[model samples]
Target: MPSLTAACATPGMRRLRILPACLHEYRGFSALRPWRRPDAVLGWGRKPTALKARRFAARHAIPYVALEDGFLRSWGLGVDGHQPHSLVVDHRGIYYDATRPSDLERLIHAAPFAAEELARARRCMALIREYRLSKYNHAPARALPAGDRPRVLVVDQTAGDASIEFGLAAAATFEAMLQAALAEHPEADILVKVHPDVVAGKKRGHLLEAARHHPRCRLVGEALAPWSLLDAVDSVHVVTSQLGFEALLAGRRVVCHGMPFYAGWGLTDDRLTCPRRGRPRRLEEVFAAAYLRYCRYANPYTGEPSTLEATIDLIADQKRRHAQLAGDWVGIGFSSWKRRFVGDFLGARARLQHVARPDDAPPTAGIRRLVWSSHHQALEALERQPPAAPLWRMEDGFIRSVGLGVDLVRPLSLIIDASGIHYDPRRASDLERLLNDTTFSPHLLDRARRLRQRIVSAGLNKYNVGTPAAGLDLPEQHRILLVVGQVESDASVRCAAPEIATNAELLRRVRAAHPEAYILYKPHPDVVSGARLGQLDTEARRLYNRLITDISITALLERVDDVHTMSSLAGFEALLRGRRVTAWGTPFYAGWGLTRDHGRHCPRRARRLTLDELVAGCLILYPTYLDPRSRRLINVETAVGLLEQQRRTTRALPLPQRLYRGYRHLFIERH
Candidate 1:
């Protein structure tokens, strides 16, 4: 976008584009570039480095805006290092400095609380409580000490902080806050909560050590979530720390020793008052003022404008996955190439150690063992785990990648099944329970429908490699049945279709069943590329009316009237395309009402399902899709959108990857 460089020449500065350069020395600006030329200069509060910007603006006679981190700032601490997710652009003044009324204070005083805005604020507050989230989410939540005594939290802050300098606080203020907490809650246990920066050794705080230790005094030194502690406390004390504001949200009695932005608005028990902040405000009102109105949020994952609720969801999702992966993990029997991509899905916090045998996994309380789902025997053996050690089976999802996994292309989506693997019919998988027991909400069904529409509209398939071909000419007035092929020795075929497990057998059976129908045989891409097993001999190859090797599976699905398969993913894709599907063996999509199941009955999968329900379980809920670029877990729609764009640009592999794949196909497969 062109910068408003010529805006200064106009009579009024209506279109001024403010540009910030090297705003903070600690965390250099990761802001989106708009620096063609600045119509105005931007400076981060009273930081020493911002003097250059202020001087430049004064010399150039350009207007300036003050910037600070929004209340919903980041998943990491600023003092440690962070690129904030939200920023408050304050033209009036920064929110921290109490000498002047910042834009946030104005919003708090005057902004109308429309029903929609209040409703959104309520929902956001509920989410924060449910997720136990904060500005920084890396901290672990530990159980508070057991006692009958009431708990009082004394929140600490980094010394020489700007908030202290401007929020009418000093060194004596901290000591006074501690003395007040001791005197007010004499019987309560005093949890002196230190600053996160203090815990991290990044900076020193006001209350560095015990001035005079009491029997009730306990220094909270670990990097822990404030709400986790807040929930267990009866009252909170702070000298301009944000936790005092959060204590108000937690419904605790707050004693503010300094005039923090949240203080003197009839919210906190303020020792010093801001005469300008005299109006009474509800917690939701304050939240609405700070988060929804004053702050401008951008999604860290996708780098786009986002709402508070969406950012909360994003952070909560990451936190939940991180907590799961926060423990020691042992990946059993993953190939060397596959190992490189596993951590993207497992989590950045997980300490992953790949091993050859299941026994190599430490049988510790916080350890988890994961095996590739195709290794059924090993997963079966590992399932008899002792207490506290979790086991999961991993497999590629339907919308896998733009190129074949057999060709060493990294997959976008994979299923992390805590129950049995999806393809296995001997027992129930998480997908089976999802299909059997889940009450598919209208919202989810609609999402599934739209996702299916997007997939069909984009003409996307599992390995989106082939281009859409022109419709194949066939005998008129005859039903067309597509017989899908799979790797003969694959686990799905071995478990579900022992009788009709091979491509030749599947083709012969289909041809005999639909003798008059025009039959087209579509072999698995792995077999076509000579990467894995399965292909037909000369006599067996003649069992079909036509063979489709070049056209994309999506194009073939659109052209075919019906589909026949012995446990192939293409069968499910065909169902998504709204075709009549006959499963010779039990695929995950089979045994539900969707497909005609001719295989061994799965007593567990007895529920009838709509097409959308099948999609909700298999595509939406069961799989975890990771964005290769962002390394962030994305929803199916995002994965599909990425796949569509990639398919358009990448119908064929690049030279280096192609050469590498060729070498693997020839040398590795041949061996």
Candidate 2:
């Protein structure tokens, strides 16, 4: 097959989906028509490949719809094999083809946007600006020329683009736009933004030939974020470029030299006019018609239908996580198992080097240091002799996995602490600072509440192991006190619980504290499987009234009224379940006034916190979740949904099939 660029003759078109655009999206429309056409012809907007489709449609008397990329498409470019999240379906004509009325143009002329519609449009616009989002969000921040002069931005587009050819624009039109910008503002510096296609070296642009030599002009060719470019400019000039509409949405002065779809709507200063346009409309009204009514959106991850606002938030979140992890780092003492998955959280832009110890690591400029938090010996060694780079500690998050980590099951979430790790309460961790100092906004609190409800109702826990306690004799009405166990050799237990370090000691203390309460002792799953230390002593069984085994911790939590622990994650789960939690040691979740703190009055945690506030700092904000399928960092809500779906789907399958799938996805990590 011919290369996409070779056949299409446009830079970056090689990565394009290549099938006819708008018409493919209209298959249902064609089917719903009274004529009962089950199939219809589709073509990419004005591409040469669509010529055959047009001929086939004409010959067979089938309706043809032209497909174009929507205004807000994907995070990356269509030419880079990133498919469109949104598509423009035009039956009358494509939007960029100004020779005829397009469906978008018809919507702009006919749609009556009331107050409610306009309000939504306004909010969407505000969020776009607030997030600094553009159609393609993969670009990095730009380093424009430093100056205080007013900037006049001139946009450039790829040569031979259908939008220019059909919008009554040519090489001379770009020249005129550049000249007008320079001539209009005598003291203003002219910023010539080279099109992304041109930057990718797929094609040439028109403005470069005219604006290259001018002392007042500077060519911007880097793959920089377009919103940042718009922020830097006072006014914008364009000929059939979508940046003109974005500039208008951003409240910048836009001058259009050609009759693009947005030009005739009376939102811009236009050099060319289309006589078919209707009454003057506000920016929000135009936006409501174009984005809310004339386009169709799909979730980029699932290809399911989605609203524009939701897609915007999704893109913004992805961009935010990418920005946070975009740097070089040195990894210290990550085991052979963990080495497979660390890169997923570090992001594609980061460069990571693994070193056995802090002393052997080389110091480099602008690089960070990362180490596993549970490696107590290494962490203490690092504290004794610090490395040159800043250190970051990471551990498995609260909602970890379906199976035990000792069984080689990879975690879906991780906690990254720049201060100390969350388990070590001797010093304040980042999670502590967030709880103490940061103000919790209503929106964040609401999100945290929803997340907590989901976790509680679903009976989610640290490891999500076992089924509810069953086939064991226990009292129904009596007050219950559950004692959670931990690995005796674990660093957290050694560091946090100096007074109480074993399961037997925890059980004995719980029985002493609650003399009448029914004491139930549960051992850690790792201990049950003989993977680590901290097995319950056979002689110590007499300390508690009941010994529980072969049951899910989450299910057991519901049977108990109060949970006592020396720093187990199960105590946190019990708190979420509305059971009273008594902390025997200083866990991260304890000392916040939410749990009964018998361990230590650190004096640092003097403030009382609501359940939702505690959850907000611990679950939603502190930890980052990874999508197992895509190997991308996601939020806690998405993580919950993934685990829920995975568990349900695995159970529904046959035993043999489940085993086969498990083998296929054994490692489930990225290098």
Candidate 3:
């Protein structure tokens, strides 16, 4: 065998490209069509796509290569071009098609493993097993069947698929293997795991009705994740499925009835053999060649070439997020437009029961949790007779800033917890508790610091609205102070700033105090978009040097030396940018010795806080941010990435959408 690097560097290697370059995505009715020309052809498979590409390549002398998805695939649907995180592109031939000597077999036999390569392979293998990750990292469809007896899982494959035709060489092979498993291990609990495609109605399988009812047999029809099945069973019986490879990865006994690439290797109990694969190999050697050396991976988040460790971390994070999305639905009492936003942001994970009024009981069928606003009428009704389900308080995030110029708005960030909300003055909020506590982990602080740097550098704010703040002029001799305004009727101002009732009164006070300073007043997005109150009259507009409405909050923060706000998150954003902040109201971010507070301060928050600590509590710990695209709960780091992408890619709303928004705005204002 040649050096893998040398093989890749070969001029001919450039032409030795893999085909059906990617799996085609399933878009339902629109996607149901015959396979068109692919970038190259995938070979030796009985599937229509594979057979067509194979013939076309041969007929036209087009270079074609065959490949298999490597160990860690993805957390979503694997086939149909959803994109695999890892794959084994074979130039010689498809690795599973036992008729030919493939590059994988040659590499397994002859590729020299340095100590570093072996160590890395071991680490990669450990992560795969630990996470129970696979080509698609999904939770099992059903629990493992209840039986104390030793279990033997007979993995089924799609009939007429590539693996069945090329490796098994017989159509009836799956049935033969199932019968053999039951005959050999008669006392064992024989669980025949059905193919996912078969369960999805996308493909056919070989499971007979008669075999399913056999006393020892329990046809495992659930779309259980492959890894979950592999982990539960003592041994795996297969006629060439990726599950056999995964079973080997998990150190389970693998009995291959047909020649999979992993089968001919001495580690597995093989009923079929590849004569060319004569050299016996260890798991790490095979893994190192197939995964670390052979496969190509693109990070699902960034679409850049990724390391196995990074991909594993990402998959694990997504899995947790998916689990979060699947949690019990919360019956939110009383209706607000924001409730719809909450449901959309939370995605399909938690169910939202939008009760039209306090008298409306939540749907009894699936209601186990309750969430409501602090001042909502439903809160009073629930207090009269508390339900069995736990209650959580929901509120907006500090950086909830983007939908300013238009009537449209979304809570890109929100908080939901058992503790009181951030703006509430009556009870201690979760954020206040975090801020006052001194025992936060060093790792949490470090993460906050990194997040702060990322947030600042990316120029991301709640709204990410507005154009360049570039040309706005500041007089050379005076200090520039930004006066941030908020919705006069918003709950935060009503609760936190009792003294400063209106934007005009707040502006008058700020202007009188900083008479010499260049005051720049920016109205809240809702005000600018005419969705809510706080629009200034012509006489009131002249109180500031300039009334800024078009520039981005981040840009304005960068230009100003100081920011004064009632309880606007702009003060917090300015704090992250190292600007001096003066608070006219006792916002959650105040009284930690971080700002000059005028209204109120929590006696509990006596500790002088770092920006990261503040960030950890406010942004990381407290809020639930949803990815605008995926609509799943994402970490602040991921949120920053998404928001930055949003900032870079955000365009003016479509005319139709804008018109619809106007109608929605009128309805909202009236209500």
* Global local distance difference test of model 3: 0.70
Better of 1 and 3 by lDDT: 1
Instruction: List lDDT for all candidates, in order.
Output: 0.77, 0.76, 0.70
State the lDDT of candidate 1 residue by residue for 549-568, as single tens digits: 87888888888899999999
Q: How far is candidate 1 from the true structure (C-alpha RMSD, Å)?
A: 5.7
Output the lDDT of residue 237, model 1.
Answer: 86
Each prediction's TM-score versus the true structure: 0.82, 0.84, 0.70
- Angstrom error at residue 353, model 2: 2.4
What is the TM-score ranking, best to worst?
2, 1, 3
Task: Rank candidates by lDDT, best first.
Answer: 1, 2, 3
